[model samples]
Target: MKAGFSAFERYKMKGRFKWIAAAAAVILCVGLLFACKKDKGKEQEDISESTEAQAQAQASGEEGESEPARAEEEDPNKLEDGMMRSYLSGLPVDEKIGNRRPVAIMLNNLEAAQPMSGISKADVVYEYVVEGGITRLMGLFENYDDLDKIGSVRSCREYFVYTALEFDAIYMHFGQAAYAVDLLAQDYVDNLNGLGEAGDTCFYRTTDRQAPHNVYTSASGIEAGIKKLGYREDHYDGYKGKFKFCDLNEVVTNEGGGSAKHIEPDYKINKPWFDYNEKTGKYDRYQYGAPQIDELTGEQLSYDNIILQYNKWAQLDQKDYLAFDCHSGGIIQYCTKGMFTIGTWRRDVDSAKDGNVDMAPVRYYDMDGNEIEINNGKTFVCVIQDSALEDIVLE
Candidate 1:
């Protein structure tokens, strides 16, 4: 009876040990599965963080690369209000000139007026044939407020009126030709004619020179004339600018471009040539075998830009008077610093305006149909007869 009881106790202890082993196996399997899931979750989290960091780095790099390029594309000389660039020279100024008018003074380039007064102060100077074979000059001045005198004023030509109107300028002349008189009388054209009723107030005679060559005007006189005429002080609503300009910081050497070290445009009257000075990066002006000096500055006249424009011309009536087709498109050569390129120029005529021809603006373009860019400084415009283009010499 004691042996059988001991056998039963042993059997019960073995059964208990079997159940304990099964429970330990189940716990080990659950721990292995949980470790795998935790490891996969950590791996996924690491991948997501790496992708986010890469995306942020790429975005930052792109912005950093584009900023400088964008700045270079836009005009570097752009400024805020109260400061503006001169339309003729591309230089900065304090006044907003869009509203103000330029003064276009007709100057005699005859032997008597060889060393003209106040010419160096002009922002732009236009030379073209008048009556006979002689050439006359029309000076466009923007900053002549303090100039004591402007010219030995000359008579106006019909073509010169068109040039003055391009800038919406206040035209000043000692007299007018028969063709120009009718055009100047138009309400759209604002002029200060020395021979007209306003002559006494707008011009004065200097004893330093003779009759017609002695007539001169000053900035104060011009201001008084503007007040008397009641002309608009600001630009017209739809008025646009004339030329495209290089940035102030940019230096246009025109490398690999055609050279323009010396340029001569034949006017037949005053044989003029411009010699480029490498040191000054400017062209010293010469006319009639001598350096043309302005009596006001006592320095030889110089220019940063020179435009030789070829236009269609005809002899008006039987007289020596000539007429230029100012509205027509024609060839032009642009010279800046010491380089040049061929281009074209046309007047932007708005047919909608009808008889108001003064509203049109002169536009310039390169051979590629893009606007020709000019250097920052004063400009000299020579209107050569189209048939006489062969007379121009350049090296």
Candidate 2:
């Protein structure tokens, strides 16, 4: 009986120990679950706080942290206002205007045609000797919508036509020299001649000036002539610009360059010169002992860049029609920001055989063989005879 009571007591004690172990195990599991839930809640709180801070930062316009992502997707060459860079001026312009082909109009630079109308608006201007020690002007206008009177239109020279080709411009003139007739009649030359069938529609004589110097073309007349001729109004599909320009916001000082505060291209006639204006950062033009003012605007003509392109030239015939070596390489002097630099200008002569010569731009390179950069504005190019290079004075 004593041994049976001892076994029963041992069994009861074992059952109590088992119950206590199971209760402790359940309490430990509950505590672990609560701790995991608290940890998950803290993680969610951290995420919520981070998002809220970002939103606040954005609202306060302190979004510098996110700028890198936005900048990565933005185009460095394009302006924020959806304006396109102009091929001629390297300035912001409407896309339609920027993409259209520029017009190269020949202007009479005789003393009788002083104060030329609409000349100040030209994106680029070329001055070269025509004949009899006289100089003629070829103004390239990229945007001429508001120009009422563009020129006292003059005849075209073969060399002027080639210069116009460099810009892929629609060559415009009242007439052409005999030497230019064969070249102008070619299919590649898209010119609006005042002496041709489009004459009545594209040009008119102003009573304010005399016969040869009175012939003028307006913006409407140019548009009408282009529409009547059915010429392509836009630039070529793969037309990269002729010039490489600096950014609009940037200014190139031409550091350590030669002084170009005053430029005098001493032609036998007209005697054109330029004075650098510190206030406007442009070269103010002067010719025939006075400012080269625009008749319509009453404003003097100015340019951001001045290029002296020296080329081998010759008189073609007894009539003295001039021919310049446009296809050949030549010495070039580029001036801007009151300073000047020497460079070389070249064009691929082989391109002429491929019928794509006009599409090839005359490239400019420094002595180091690197392409030179031009400022963003109107340019004045003086096509001087290489023999007369010493006549040019840059003070």
Judging by lDDT against the true structure, name the best candidate: 2
Please provide TM-scores, in order, for all candidate models, with all chains considered together.
0.80, 0.80
lDDT tens per residue, model 1, 125-211: 999987778899999888888898889899988789888888878899988887676677777778988887678888999898778
State model 2's lDDT: 0.79
Question: Candidate 1 — what's its lDDT?
Answer: 0.75
Model 1: which ten-residue window has the lowest total lDDT?
Answer: 32-41
Error of 2 at 365 (Å): 0.6
Q: Candidate 1, TM-score vs. the true structure?
A: 0.80
**Residue 330, model 1, lDDT:** 82
**Cα RMSD (Å) per model?**
34.1, 32.1
lDDT values, one for every candidate: 0.75, 0.79
Error at 336, model 1, angstroms: 1.3
